[model samples]
Target: MDYKDLRKEYLKHRLDPASLHADPMIQFKLWFDEALQAKVDEPNAMVCASVSAEGKPSSRYVLLKELKEDQFIFFTNYHSRKGIELFETKFCSLVFYWRELERQIRIEGIAEKCSAAYSDEYFNSRPHGSKLSSIVSPQSSKIESKEYLESELKRISGMDASEIKRPEHWGGIGIRANYIEFWQGRQDRFHDRVCYTKTESGAWEISLLAP
Candidate 1:
């Protein structure tokens, strides 16, 4: 197979500044809803990027747990790479791509820990195995082998679900976006791009960008 010969031409949609919502969060929810309606797989999954105090960058996929008050929420172990990095830098970015819709959304902003009550509410709503995995698996930690994780899960198996508390090291964080960009695929690679940035006065300014 000739790798260079493979290509995809985007013709799914077009995005214009005039058609966007004044609030980027509202726009995001609209797109997100469309994605869900279109039956996109894991539509809430997004790429989370963070930088460490040493300026090292990290990226991974995390599921969006909630969106409210212009904030996007996700959960993870407080000791995970992303959590530690956010703790040190107080900033992060997330990218959502719905290939079926030929669209992508990028967000950048400050990240802060959610209230413990909110975290607890969300954690309690998770499936039993997900809660157990968080309790047993040391996310982002170097372990000897996969067997160690399996053994740890086994160790927690006998415990009652109600008795298993949300680990102190695991919880939720919310990204309060300062900048948001929406991209839509166009024919011949002239993709459409629009960016919205928050101003000091709490208003958003929208701009069109070159593809």
Candidate 2:
């Protein structure tokens, strides 16, 4: 199969600086709403990219659990590769690709761990099985086998839900985006890309880039 021939022509979905919300967060929410309306599976799932202090970059898929005024939130094990990278550099990027809508959103920013209280709240809200899994698995660590995980989970079967607490190594991270890019597909590969970057004055400046 010819890889180049696999490409599909894009349909124009133009975006302009004037048409965008002054607050990039609002714009992101609008796009996310559209994605939800389109019934995109796992709409909250996004690609999280982080670079180690030594400059090695890694990316993995994670779910976006919350979006606040100036930050995006997701949960993970603090000792995981991405978490360690964030701890070292505090910078990361998030990318959301909606293939059905032919749209993508990219954000770059500094990340910080959310408060312990917040982590506890979110953890308590998770399903019983998820809470048990979190308690049993040492994320990013080598496990003996699937049976080990199953056996560990079984041990917690009769535990009371209210007694389950957030693990010390697991929590949420919030990325405060200083740069955001919105991409829309167009015909003939003339895709539309708009970037919003925070200036020194703490205001955002929008610009268009050639695809």
Candidate 3:
């Protein structure tokens, strides 16, 4: 199979400089709304990239659980590979791509742990099975077999909702973005790129980049 042939032209939309929002967060919300209207699958799913203490980089998709005034939030096991790296470096990048809309958003940010209270609130709101799994699964650790997980799940399945509490190792990470770039696909790969960088005075400076 020739992989070079697996390509398609982007002719869906074009982004205008004047149409961009002064605030990157606002711009993100606007695109997010459009993504929802376009019926993009899991529009809130983002690729979270983190670097280890040794400068090794890794990425994985995580659901965007919340978007705050200055942060993007997601939850995971604190002991997970990404989580450990985040704790160590506190530096990360998030990417959101909506193929259906021919658009992508890139964010560079600092990662911080959310309050324990907030984590508890979100955890309690999750489905029963999810809550159970979070407790049983030692994320990013080696496990013996699928049967072990099945057995663990079975043991905890009978616990009532009140009995299930968010474990100490499971919580939310909020990323405070300092730079954001928005990309819109155009004809012949001449894409539109608009970016926002935070200034020293906390103002956002917007710029257009060549495609």
Best by lDDT: 3
- Taken over the whole model, the C-alpha lDDT of each candidate is 0.92, 0.90, 0.95
Report the lDDT of model 3 for residue 143.
82
Candidate 1, residues 64-102: lDDT per residue as tens digits? 989978789999999998999998998899999999999
Model 2 RMSD in angstroms: 1.2
For residue 144, model 3's alpha carbon misses the true position, in angstroms, by: 1.4
Q: 64-156 in candidate 3: lDDT tens per residue?
A: 999987799999999999999999999999999999999999999999999999999999899888999999999999987879988999998
Cα misplacement distance, residue 114 of candidate 2 (Å): 0.2
Task: Give the TM-scores of the predictions, in the order they appear.
Answer: 0.96, 0.96, 0.98
Q: How accurate is candidate 2 locally (lDDT)?
A: 0.90
lDDT of 2 by residue, 52-152 (tens): 99999999999999997779999999998888999898889999999878899999999999999999999989988888888888877887788988987
Lowest summed lDDT window (length 10), candidate 2 = 9-18
TM-score of candidate 3 relative to the true fold: 0.98
| Positional deviation of residue 121's Cα in model 3 after best superposition, in angstroms | 0.7
**What does candidate 2 score on TM?**
0.96
Cα lDDT, model 1, residue 163: 97
